[model samples]
Target: MVRRPTERPGRNDEPDLPPNLFVIGLLHDLKEGGYSRHAWAAFWRASWIRSIQILEMSAELRASWLRFSVTGIVLIALSTVAVTAYFGIGQGIPFALTSVLWWGILMFDLAMHLGLMVNLESGELQQTLGWPNRLTELRGLAAVWVAWGAHWASAGVYVPLVLVFGLAAFTDLLDGWLARRRHASTRWGRLYDPFMDGLFFSVAAISLAVVGILPQWLAALVTLRYAFPIFGGITFLLIRRRTLRVRHTPWGRASSAGIALTVFAAALAAALGLPFQALAPFFYAAVGITALGAFVTILIRGIEQI
Candidate 1:
């Protein structure tokens, strides 16, 4: 089943953020000195210089632009790797990278779109985002790429795969804990945090399924479990041109946690030389909770909209 893309946010209720120092300074100068012919003529030159200086020194400006630049660079690097592998390296690149590339660009747009909101408010933006939180999203993206690696990973390499996947899963929890500890939760976090969860877990499930590490039936459920909300989110953004901002719910968190645990269990069962049937009990329970959670979340959002 095709699942909708997950994502969202709105800002009407939010108070306007203040302009950065450059703008504030210009405004202050004009208000204090009033407009004179020479000063007015010189103002543009001074403003341009001051703006450049401020942008160079401003942490927020650097951070926002830096994120966009870095993502663009990654895309280029992926493309280069793909081309090199196909041509120079005599190793064919996986076509899956195309999907990964587009997904990444979409995420890049989302990051910039959200980052711009708090850009002018350096203090607040810094408070709302940190290296740890950003790393979580990057980890999610890594999981997506890693999922493709599952195609090549099998019985012999399953151990390393499990350990790598475990790290990605750990980051999911780490980001939120870091945010809460710092009191840095923001609209971007609320919207994109779960979005990353869906992406990471879904891709991993699909890859594992392809490699026979997971049952096709279980993979389908897991995929749709993430797809529904994600596609719903993407649809919302396309039509409304804004984020959905669904309230974080208990069941939703449980669903994500359940998926992470269940996948780990599946990997572990393989690692331990246990039968797939042995994990049936755990998988069934996790699926039940996950499906139930998705239904409830969809229902709640429906009620909210009405």
Candidate 2:
């Protein structure tokens, strides 16, 4: 018996198929894959692509800055060694080590600013703008290293270094305000801004600890603000397979401001030859309260998401 035309196998009687059957089949396979497998693949792909792009972009962007960086580093190193030997040989080096350290920091900051500008302009021109996570990561690492160097300088010349630290802190505030006011804010700025702030505070706390200007407990408390949140963020991303959305929460901003002020106060007290121990209790208390507030805010937000 002849089948009806409409009912013939592989004819219009069959379910409609995609014109690009191969592409459709591949997409279907992707969706059917386990979530973890798909997630890992996506993560690795994103990370690999980002690394390649950042390396290429950074090479172009930092060419001039790298020259400056090398020159500055060499000069600073030579100055440091010379000053050390002179001091050992009973010839006062006329300049504080802290000054050299600050100079190095300023140079590093200039390099970073240059890199950031190049990256932002390139992104705009290419219409490839998005959050620059790799650049942000690099900036964060740089901040931490700078802070470490600053702390060493502070320990060597505590009073003069405090001034440099204060100025650097102020620049952090100014840069953000300028970016916002000029309407030049970008995804890269948002990530870099906070990472720098955290690094600055963390480094300052380390400096204070080294000089016995702050109680160990106080320094630890301040460090925990950044450390705990960082850990939490990593955990969330691993479990949820997504980065936490950046938000400008009032409490978060307040916490950061409070931390900065506390560090500034501690530095001032040290510089003034005041008994910094008395302020330790207050510092610890402020850190605890701000940290608690920040934690509660994060917890509430996490719950809301659920």
Candidate 3:
């Protein structure tokens, strides 16, 4: 008598099962095993849950920082206006200058706190979003912003502010080096780092101009340091349809160092009440050359990529 296929037993199967029964059973087991574990783990993990919590926390933090930054800027502006009002208030020796400088300090503090928040946000985003080395970028930009604010505040003081500014400038370089050495370079950090440097330098130049410390021509050149790059960036974006990349170049590094040194030297001269005019020509020349080199580098690199 012939048994049906399902009724037949083979060595591959259990003694009670047919030949195809084992294959069917294995498939069924695999299907039942499915992705449930993955789903369950994702929902229950600390990292995932903390990401949600951090979103809310970051929102609150960003709000607080924005409020503080705005308020500080407004106070600084008002304090500057109070400079004229000092004469009206009958205060001796322009007490409003002190108020303005104090406002600068407040602004600096706010900027620093904002930077801290950025660092925290970058760190959280890295884990939550799979971004690499973003915290390093954030720290770089933060260092620049902090340095800028310190420089502004120092401008309102004598030599003490310059020392603080110098320290901050040094930290900006140090932070970038640390980031690279520590393997913490990220896209966000790269973009923001140079952007913040441009902003800081622009603001410093403008502040010096406002205080009559920087001659108008030299101030214009300093301002162009930012404007030239920004214009190039915009042009490149418009024409080439590519965002500028931050390449490590010796000339670029030297240009930055030169500009920083020039600013320090100028500040020192101002503090000493010495004639800073001789330094002005050299400073402007350095700025112009650097700006030109940067522009050429960006333009050439951008075009070559296309």
lDDT of each: 0.61, 0.54, 0.51
Candidate 3 or 2, higher lDDT? 2
Candidate 1 lDDT tens digits, 1-306 = 112366223321222223235434554564455656665566577766654554555576466656755664565477447546644443224434554565567555544444433422234444234644575557656565556457436635565468767888888888777665555555455566677777788788878888887778777887787778778765654344344545556677787788788788777777777886766777768777767877777867744644
Error of 3 at 211 (Å): 1.8
Work out the TM-score per prediction: 0.64, 0.60, 0.52
Off by over 4 Å in 2: 1-46, 54-156, 277-280
lDDT of 2: 0.54
Tens-place lDDT digits, model 2, residues 1-306: 123577556311211111223223433444455546775586456545544455456564455445545654565566456646644423223233444555566555544344234233223411222223323333343343344444544655454356656666666666655544444545445545666667667777776677666667766777777676667765664455444544445677677777777777777766677776676677667777877898788778665544
True-structure lDDT of candidate 1? 0.61
Off by over 4 Å in 1: 1-61, 64-107, 114-123, 127-129, 234-243
263: Cα error in model 2, Å? 2.1
Clashing pairs in 1: 4-230, 4-231, 5-230, 5-231, 6-230, 6-231, 8-243, 8-244, 9-243
